[model samples]
Target chain A: MSGPAATEAAPAVERWTPLSRISVVAAVAIIAALAFGPLVLNPDWVDKLTTLFIYVILAVMWNALAGYGGLVSIGQPAFFGLGAYAAVRLADAGVNVYLSLVAAALLVGLAARPISAFMLRLKAGEFAIGMWVVAELAHLLVNLDGLVQGETGTSLIAMTAYGAESRRAAVYWLALAAMAVLVGVVFVLLRSRTGAAIQAIRDDEDAAAAVGVRVLATKRLIFILAAAGTAMAGALWLATAISFQPKTYFGVQWTAYMIFMVLVGGLGTFEGPLLGAVIFFTIEAWFGGSGVWYLVGLGATALLFSLFLPRGIWGAVESRFPLRLLPVGYRLRGAPKSL
Target chain B: MTSNDDGAILAASGIHKRFDALVVLDGVDFAMRADEAIGVVGPNGAGKTTFLSVLVGAHQPSSGRVRFRGDDVTRLPAAERCRLGLARTHQVPRAFGGMTVFENIFVAAANGGGFSRGEAYDRCIDAISLCSMMSVANRRAETLGLLDRKRLELARALATNPVVLLLDEIGGGLSDGEAGELVETIGELRRRRIAIVWIEHIVHILLQVAERLICMDAGKVIADGSPTAVMSDRAVIDAYFGEGAA
Candidate 1:
């Protein structure tokens, strides 16, 4: 049905911002520079950057889960550990290690479907703790496997066959590629119709349902994506570190780091978690030697950000600059601006 | 159960909704023809909102059936019902706080109406313009004042391209001038041939647009007729003011 014509011209909806356009160029340049990191950076720095990539993957996945989907899972380490184990089993069966990483991610993503069906029945707090229980259960189940070797851990022996320098460089490239691909996937998803539904679910579930958003289905999709993404990060971490201990892989500290990173960067914004990961990496690199004091400092910093900068650094920056580097929201042109 | 032989666009029969031991709606039956504008009014605790909830599939009736366009929709979820051309607004606006006003409407147009991106954009522009929300279309929904929030609520529902729209107290907490504007916009919706079931406390404003009126009390509809007739009904007057006052 036609609407009554307005006295003025109809407003046009614009998607891209000036900063969003510049961000595209900036992202390309950054990825290209990072691609050359192994060639110029020292071996130690190369390895550190690979580790940093793992952190980025984790933060981004967690942000998508809690920030967008409104599913605050504290049990992501379950999928992370499972991914590492899946890769280990694949490598043992003579699959190429690189191929095993991708396969591991896909397998974990599929596994999350049934789990999400059960988990989605729960509300906010119940879902969060339920995930932790699921993660603990996975840790126990993995411990039962002979290949896991009961806390002694197992090395990715296939990785040992390659020359040290070439292996490090190749692994670095793989980590970089995984991070880039996952981030791109999330970006594209957020720009789609499904992305709008996901954020709508986050804002208010009942209203979203009334507005015709398939809330459960959308939440399940995000849950699966997050599971697969986190698993990819875990598999990459396994390759870089060259070892997998169920205890360490399934440890709660991974979830803590994810929370810290996402909280410090920004919870809901696309660019927030990325910036959070960088800030987190810098802090870890600088003060990791402080041992126990470092842990205290990290906790203290996250608490301060939560209290004072509740929106995180990116939120503060956006409020001041009014720019969107990744504009998922619409902008109406030819409309009177709000005071 | 009431039969749908009258060619009603929407119908609900014998709807009984109970929360624990308390009954919010007791054997409530309602039917509306295509493009019919009905206004629901009742005193506090009269179950007006609860009946709307049951009709829109937000709250399932303990025992009853809901049908839309000759299809059984009692078992369908709210989203499914919305996609089937049934949409609703909450008494309190529930706009997506992080999104702009335009995005809120766009989402409904795209998802509820199942339109392509271009069509959804066109639908959004129509809904926004009809609701007189053009000036603040780019502002975040959370920043909107009460009147604009109500407008966003109506616009979002309109964007769904609904065959039937259920509004729960859309005029609540609005000044007389603000509500008058809403009445005009709603009148425009009626002209577009979209059936509306609006629940409001403002009787005169509702009377201006409602072709039929239903007054409910204590989980039962006490009056159902033309606006003037329902307003003059002894039971409706008694429902509004305590018993024996009429």
Candidate 2:
């Protein structure tokens, strides 16, 4: 089982320790298996998982924005709707659906700069409501023109070119890829200087400013990042549905679901949202056929989780175990252990 | 802006600060030499801390000029002033409570002082070691006791590699032994030629490190001279120690 004899001059300290390497490798292997799932799973299951992936992205983005950045926004659906509309319109114009998805997300990211300039001026609760107002405004404007077909809605006709099986497979892979890339970006950023500065601002704005952290600028960056990732998830959702309505895309329910997922998972930790998304998706898949009871159950579950486990499932687990699958912050190591 | 001009690292002239008709600082003029230690003594609400805040860019003076090495920095923000090597510790000991002790100093050295990554790490280690905080360097700042928190406040400011350090009542709540330890740290800092302006109620501790001492009351300087003379001045005795105290 041993690959080689022990080297006498191994490093006393390592930035990428063997334990961390194992975590990274295990994550990559799991992702690869998920990417190949459409090959064996039924079309309906692949479709269900595609929806789960989009929620995963939403939950993760919301967690970072609120949990780490101290910006609890309720208006993320604004960009989500914009991205969905962009994707549908581009596909209608005969562009590649995949390319249109990316372009729509980028367009949303660009719009975030100006949006943040206005929204970030508001403090915590005001900021949350401000985002909702922005989403409502976007909904009204999208209905103003025939470009989105207003209330009549529209479909992604470009998808008709592919067979049902191939279409399902492509959509699943696209969702998986988008989730991996966005989560990976967040992971990398949380390990960098920008992440440190953002956490500093989260802890104390005045102290962070005194230490030369550009407070407003860092908030703006996080706002834009959350917007971009949320928009990309929106675009993927449109691809999954192959159809969209303004009311459907711009619903406040998206924000509610995001909050539920992250709240039940944990706030600041990386594993919280991922674990939350899986649990929520599993519960929905099992009991969703009951319609209104399903939603009621979800609401009750969220309330119970909030009251009993304020830190969420992952948060509780982390407190007990101190497990860090993605260790971004530093932990001083003891002297090297003897074999 | 020359660092050697007038041999002063910081100069504030005709500084005035008011909050809705309440004058916190009244036409205060102060200056610090490149290698000097000055002590400020006054009763509570005498605007001692307010003066330090104005000097460090935490407050905007109503009408005045603040010169750092002969360059006006009155309009600059707190972060900019910190980056330019003017740093201060808060009276309440504000440490970055969520971060480790080492991370707190690292952030100050890297961001406030503009040191490179390697140099900032070195500077942080040096600062904590100087403050005798190496044992708690990995601990979260919020977990520290009063003495360690005070040490962290000082160490965090020191990590900024300041040209002129403004200290506000860091010795107020310390035991005599703890205060003595802090005095030793400040003495070591003075040996490095860093200008120090310390505001303290502990007159004896102030007398030990400050070559020149100034007394203020009702937002104006009442006495300015050598430490011994200022301590014994009739006006200082009346304003700070009360007329009855010998």
Worst 10-residue lDDT window, candidate 1 chain B: B237-246
State the lDDT of candidate 2 residue by residue for B52-159, as single tens digits: 888888788898888897678999888888888888998988777767777777778877888886777778777877898766766778788888988988998998
True contacts kept of 2: 0.31
lDDT of 1 by residue, B132-198 (tens): 8887888888899988999999999999999999999998888888888888988888888999999
Encode model 1's per-residue lDDT on A71-144: one tens digit a residue.
99999999999999999999999999889988999999999999998999999999999999999999999988
Docking class of 1: medium
Best by TM-score: 1
Which ranges of candidate 1 are over 4 A from the true structure? A1-10, B244-246
Report the C-alpha lDDT of model 2 over A297-334, residue by residue, as the tens digit: 77887789889997798878866774667766554333
Q: Write down the TM-score for model 2.
A: 0.90
Give me the displacement of residue A175 in model 1, in angstroms.
0.8
In candidate 2 the C-alpha lDDT for residue B69 amounts to: 72
TM-score of candidate 1 relative to the true fold: 0.96
